[model samples]
Target: MSETILEELFIKRSQQKRKASPLNYKERWFVLTQDKLSYYDYDLNKAKRKSLRGFVELEKIKCVETVQPEPNSPPERSYAFQVIYDEGPLYVFAKNDATRGEWIKKLKEKVRFNKDLIQKYHPCFWADGMWQCCQQQVKEAVGCKVLEHKNGVGFSSKNSSRRRPSRKPLPPTPEEEKPGCRPLPPQPPEEPSHSVGMTVIAEYGYTPVTPQDLELRKDEEYTILEMTDANWWKARDNTGREGYIPSNYVVNAGNGLERFDWYCKNMNRSQAENLLRTENKDGGFLVRDSSKAGKYTVSVFTKGGGESSGNSRHYNICTTQQGQFYLAEKHYFNSIPDLINYHQHNAAGMVSRLKYMVSNRAQPPSTAGLGYGIWEIDPLHLKTIRELGNGQFGVVKYGTWMGQHDVAIKMIKEGSMSEDDFIEEAKIMMKLRHENLVQLYGVCTKQRPIYIVTEFLCNGCLLTYLREGQTQHPTTIQLLEMCKDVTEGMAYLESQQYIHRDLAARNCLVDANGTVKVTDFGLSRYVLDDEYTSSAGSKFPIRWSPPEVLLFCRFSSKSDVWAYGVLMWEVYTMGSLPYQRLNNTEIADQVPRGLRLYRPQLANERIYSIMNRCWHDKPDERPTFQELVVIVQDLLYELQ
Candidate 1:
């Protein structure tokens, strides 16, 4: 009973001029004031004041009830209710049964308070300061109309006590005996002349105020009535109801089933990014057209877990103006296949890759039967020599497996990953075999401390080896040979569509024989497509990343080629760091503006040309790993 009303809303009401006129449901804005219930036509410009259509003083209302279709009512007016008053019943039809019930509930609450104010209230309609319902039309009239009715009833309390007989008993409650509530008749056929032959392409629900709007359920046909804009359309549903819906929600049915590429065209960059982030949260990606013509944007989403907890990041796979695809904007690739190949060797910077393997939940083909040279070593026979290094997934220790084989045992920390996740990673590792790639012996899954056993390189990581061996001063021929070893391993991986995301010299291991082998599958993912985007904010080796990787978090094999250029610089300089004078932040800022590492003093012109090709701004401009292997071999031959 507060004086102020609660809320106002827009609704459609069936208005009729006479008893025989057809019911026309028009949109109106309804407002409940302190003393009355009123409605007005909604103006197209909301800033303008509303013109009142009609109103009823609260004092005149007696009760309200959900009404059945009457003999005189239109067939489509089945969903309706009536407001009982002393003057007459005001009938209102809603779009649906649920709406009818809501109106009845609100009207019932107002009627209870109306009885108290009836004695002092008079029913009057005002327009131009006169009672429009009772006044005669006159030129230049500006005052109140005649106050008395033709029957001699004046607008005063002298005859206010007079009461009329009740029309009928109030409608029964749900528990009472029911009668005469027949089902409504079927609706008339829809008009066919307005058909424009469009159909709903995706499911969409109606959310606006008007009931004339139709819900665009999936596969439903809707003919276009008008094109509101590039994004919206006024369309008519099969039931003949017309309203505005997003244009993208409907399309030409004759186009047949849509392709994955079609669904992503013309989408906003942020919207596509959000879709990949939400839909592929566990680990997935999206491919869509880019802002650049004839190029596409690939989004790779990775969920962070284990040692890199809360390190989720998103990596975009896109081509620059020069047409090179990249991952995390660091690694560049000649093709999407080259980028995906790199991901197969690196999984550190993003979420799991289980989803990217296939469209279903089935695990990747088991490696149990594959002859990948996986050897099962007994944990008791393995002696822990010492800790080598720590990783996101586990800790690496130099150990002897089976009391004889020199091996690096990567013991996965407890709770770092689920048993299934570890098994999946191990299976992917077992399938890969190459001379320059580290060979996996096997995994220990039954014990508390799970171990991934692999061959041990006596000289340790290439970066550490280079730094420690600086005094030895390896010749140009020897450095080029090392570069060839890495390029060969990467070429093999590229052939398998495996991307080595963390492909710096640090991740490469050198054996006692001066051979460099690609190691560390911690940041690798097996991608079916050419690109894999990392989740947003995932940590990456910024120093090794290229301009695109640093700026946009894109990764690809061409990006690895960019890193290879840095690694080649590392070799000729005898382990000097790329961008030695600048920190990571400064390097990230300077690399995109054409700043590159200075040529190494010992690197001859031919060798420097090979490294320079790998640093091309456009990924496609970079030589493939296979081409680099050929170039490096020829350079080494010339020295020999």
Candidate 2:
């Protein structure tokens, strides 16, 4: 070895399989030095010389290149490469493309720098110890005689060409490489197809397609051209525009207007009026054009039911305000179809009748407030007792409402946010009602410093409770019970398709009975799907965030599950900060490299296993909140 002090550039802890047997793989810490690369069993305390697995001298290397997967090799090793040297080849696998590229680049640089030091380079072969191109059986075989070169001697161009004949064919010509140039694979025998007429119930509004395709729109009758797949129906629209539309967006024309059971986009103004009149004989209903470019609304009208009845008594199908479409001087809606949909369900109140109906059927009892319960609180009735705590946008105060009810009043700081934004957040909170969720009493929007009143939790934040309980030393059953409470609440939220983006022990509250209640919807979002992507430059809690959330700003229920795992760790460790030793930047760097927090001192093996499952690198692999609830409940029962 030369006296040069080789700097350690990169290090990754991974596993390496024995060349002789693919099944035999061992954990190794791969260290990449400037002059050489080696592997050793990882040590927590100090490096051990005896634990060295293997090393390849960079100077003796001839070439480094990525290799194709072998017939029987595991898929994980598909990105593997080989370091060909005079003695033999060093086979190694990387986790992904980027890592593999880095390894190859560094190794090739080293080989190029020490090109003169190479002796006789061996032909690529799968022999005594490893797999290669030139398959040989001898255990002690040296360089092949066919392409042997003297010490540091380069092969002549003529001899090199003769010894190594080009086996690969020439590249394809431009004409041959054009799109759809290759012959298509043989298709399976076609199945019998049925043709039918479908009414576009939902908007299949134009999505930009290839220049040859035409755009499809709502309410347009289409003849079924073909059934492309289970989810898509190939159809020719009334205008002779043929394309695929979502199967759910259309219904059979024979199903009739009753099949829609709500707003009919195709229904004309006269048709809507006649339908509403037939449905509710004497009851007044409103119909108006919809805010959407070509849509309408139908809403049921309740005489003298506006604000006096504690309900708007006006239900529309569409929610977005596009501009008022008037049915009468005093009655109007955003769209005419909305008005008809409201009449079909006979739903009342200011909220969208469609959402209201869905909530009544699909949601649990607590979340029935899908935009219905909102009231104005008299400021004089709320007596401020004391300041509870300050938040990002306001100060929460312990207060009494209506002289008797104790509440936490979140008073927004003047100019902190627009009144419309605050009202919108309050409306979302009002629709949520669960035993494990904080109850919103009402909002005092009429006053200057707006107040949002919610039920007060006696035990304060869960984080504070856990930290205080540390001295008392809660048992495993008690901690597991707390975790179960949080999981159950989160499960409900998940079922509602709600993502608690800021889920953490600090955001949760503990009641007098020691039950954990999920609170702080500051970052919560209601998404139709499991994932929600934040706009660029949004702030996030780094410590509790999953890898995807931290990296791509993509949030989902699974990311919340990841945070819940951290919260469970907080409970077991008595509210200690997660990744306490690493700062945000370090966490962002280390976590993607497979570093994770160790199990808390008090966490049992099973509990840690559940937490580990929650931290799976792939979001889909993480357990759902419902699953977590069951697992924790089982653990709690066992602890009892």
Candidate 3:
């Protein structure tokens, strides 16, 4: 509602336009604003809008582009544009090419600040519930083409989504958060004559697996004319020759560094040091992006025999003018991963061998929305595997998305909470992505029962992990590292000016690799917000909340910090219930009276002091999450 950028009468297609053969299209008054794009049904006789049709938040938009005309298309709808948002696309047509160009330009400017902008999109029109170009039946499937920002160039194909045949229920494996490998596709058509093909660079060389398969040459650029399946793709080489190639052999030209377990895309020297030292491994190593433009650094941990231990060394992955990469002279390789792979086996010059490959990649954060811009997931793709836990909202279950991806589906009981408001609030929460936070994948709103899909952790809640986990005698360094993980995630929330409100061991989850992540964020819509009276009917986590939240119902980062202190107490006491034997009334009465949790026997002077600071009488007196991260990190370093 900031300012109206442009307004015009657009020939828009109905949401179910793809369901019919001829396609239903209509004329509507479209208004473009800084925050949203809205379309209205006009009263022709009155010369004004009769009713509001629909609107899309610009921030939720992933891609905006012109759609290529389908073969045997109508002339009036020839000049068309598409606005792709969470889960679906909005197709709008302009009268001429100039009008479409102007609207597209203004939209691009407004959405340039979006955090989840897509790099690819489908160019051709959709019909019969499928993409005409790619033949992908799923409306939310990823585009088969690449995107050029300025013109929004995209591609197409013969048939889309060569997915595997529906199989039996997959055994619930304990391999936490593991993404299953995908199968090759069915078929891909071709791109429109005016559109540019999706381009990629070959990362590995490959011999033809079949007579139909093309040989792949490393470091060569190829235009993807068609992506037939998940494995084989039809591509055109430099000489304008086309053939089939293995999809794994090539990567999005500049996105090769994205597919490694040892690579940390956004880690600095200090974070690298902290992670390596906290891991306390004799040969832990990780590759991180360098502060210098276009460079990378390798951080390794090694323990010197007997005399000294717990030492870390860092080296830059240097590159030569000829494009060869090397960690040391005369040991050049084709890529950075290759360089690290060599060092993982041989030290050659520096510290101990790059032994154990380390990274937080085991729990890579989920994208803002699922596949492409899909925020609202299709209920048809969700299958309830089993119940994990029961909560205030409803039961959370282990589930599969599209029979491939593992997801935690939280089924919201009908009429228990305000549905419309929760949906809108969820749209914002889905934007947050941090390694220490549980990710919200998407939501299912089309059916009678709504489901909230989120990232699934293997080991369940932290409270259970602390009590039920086999390792009863966790070392001081190990406890401090756990505290550090929760703090790092909280620190990110603090920086975003968002508050967790409810931070506790029960709310934190542990992954298979022993990493703890914060969950249940941004659920304040129907949750226990300031308006909650905490009567007998309402059940909430009062023990972990601060005095400010307990007495006045005021929530902020400081309140969350106070809860962190209590959560730490829970951790040290090995998951003992907070304020044991004391009721909620006693906690509400005693917490504001300056009664704080006592230090655990395991917590030494230094660790207790940090916890005490978080329980300061005044909210402002408590340390900020950023400051807490530093203090906890220092304690970790000392213990290590």
Candidate 4:
């Protein structure tokens, strides 16, 4: 055999051996493609190939025209070959550093092999979906065009162009009857009366009725009617026996429905509705009021259905005394009746509750002096200050501090309570201090109301900065640095055994120089404090909070780490809402079930790896704020 052939065989053998070795390479070249590019070890020269018994560790072949890996895949560890030729596409090795004689020989071999496979296997491109599935489809089918699906890759061709099935139309029913029943002969709709009647009605097993049979379903069924809405409905097959139907399918035959008794007795639905409207829109009924502004009930009811014969669900609504309705769990009213009653029955408690919510609902400041602070705010400042945002608490004003400095004044009308939540919040804030944390300048309690004084960030929030232009212009380095700042501040807090509880870009203020100042200690708590264990939307920033925090209502340094990961996501996406597409329960379920967001534009291998670590399903598995600081710092350095 020729010396060249012997040398070639030795090189090939060495390359094969290197594939199984765990040695690190200085750098690896990655080629751009229409499909994702994976790697396998190979040699393009006989000299290094024959000299070494393992891979030549193709180094120095970096800085390509375009190179992109999968969104959340491991870092590229091997080299890629980009062939340049006039002939039909082939995988001939480029003679980057090797001589023509050596390089051409290997290139020709690779080209020949690639050409042979071209009839069957095509080179993969970094497209919308997974790398492996695209290859599998290419191998199995003749005509394939890569398409991205939510979960993974979808390969399609002209042959697979059938239209999708259309949704079936809902069966017609009487307007007054259950929604899914068979249609009955057209009849005039009956007006329901509130008067109690001696007429007896019989109750029967579950029966499907149509809109046309509304009168029949009401008169023929049980006298005790169940009221529910159709728009916000959930369907279930009662223990496999009761037929499946939407929750709103059942309507009250009369006002005799007593399911809402528990809800009304405990909480003021008007107040609950106001609270729900301030934050969430998922559950609640809007009740019109002539004497008051508006009333809403947090209570959502499920009619008695399925196997449970005597089951009915009632929800409590919340609102402000000023007629603003909020929605809350019916239990929130029943369990914390004193708290609810105090806010509703007394004017002072109501005012104090509003006092803490000055900065933002997602980020209310720690109130040290309670409602007295709002009273201390100078009337001159209030007159000159412009209103920015309004909430149940009060209005956020852009005004001057000390009559000169540009600051924001948050004023709350004093309520009836002495100092319950305000005192606790104040104590928590007094213990926390960090460069990235917003400074609490002072409290004002000299006037008729109370107000809080804090250093006003000119840049507003990270949310506003990202929202100004057609598209956000934040640099990757800036985002990484912000992540580091957040972690650094959070690490200090974590060390002191305090949980920020709510960590989001909206809660963070950005200075003119781009420094991030974490604000809002209203929802924060001490690490070991066992005062509250309830999981309400108010207590937790549902979008930014971790699954453990929502499900267990338990927090630790790990919970803060989870919030930090969400904050990182918010920064990368230019202040997009976390879990924006998912519902509260969905957010809670997915995080613990390992579902997380992966942004393609900002998710480099290292950054994604860090995000994944912080977003682990297990709270214990999440890194500490200290560890997060290290990872973000390292990432910033790499980008620089």
For every model in order, what is the number of clashing pairs?
A: 47, 18, 13, 64
Question: Cα lDDT of all candidates, in order?
Answer: 0.56, 0.56, 0.72, 0.41
Write one digit per residue (lDDT tens) for candidate 3, span 3-31: 78899998888777344536578889999
lDDT of candidate 2 over 1-640, digit per residue (tens): 4343332222222222344444344445666665567777666466543366677666556566656666676667667666765444566667777878877776665555442232223444353454354342332222222223222234432233211112232122111112342222111112233455534443334342233333545555667766644334667766777766545445565533323434343222333333444443234444333322233455442323343322122322322222444433444565544445434454344333333221011111122211122357778878999988887547998988657567788887675555665465565456555556776666889977887778788789988888887327666666776777788678767765566778888888876546578886533332212232221112667778888877777777778888898888988999898888877788888887788879988987777877887887877556667656545644543343
Report the Cα lDDT for residue 211, model 1.
Answer: 45
What is the total number of backbone clashes in candidate 3?
A: 13
In terms of TM-score, how similar is model 2 to the real structure?
A: 0.41
Model 3, C-alpha of 126: deviation from truth (Å): 71
Residue 473 in model 1: lDDT: 63
Each model's TM-score, in the order given?
0.40, 0.41, 0.51, 0.40
Which lDDT tens digits does candidate 4 get at residues 385-488?
67766533356677765454556666654552233355335433543445577755444566645565666777777667665632346566656767776776
Clashes of 2: 18
- In terms of lDDT, the best-performing candidate is 3
Per-residue lDDT for 123 in model 2?
42
lDDT of 1 by residue, 1-640 (tens): 4254633444445433344556456656666655566777776577342788887766556445545464565655767665545344465656678766666566656555331111111122222433343352321111122122211222442232222122232122121112222111111122122234555453333343234444666556777877533334678877887776655445466532222222354332444444554454445555544432233554455555533222224344545323566765576777765665566566535454424421211111112211212345568767999999876556899987556457788887665555555465565555456658887767777787778788788788888888888327666756776788788788767655455767878788976545688986434433212232221113666667777788776776678888888888888887887777887778778889888888899897767767777887766556667556645644443353
Q: Which regions of candidate 3 deviate over 4 angstroms? A: 1-365, 470-472, 528-540
Candidate 4, residue 218: the lDDT equals 22
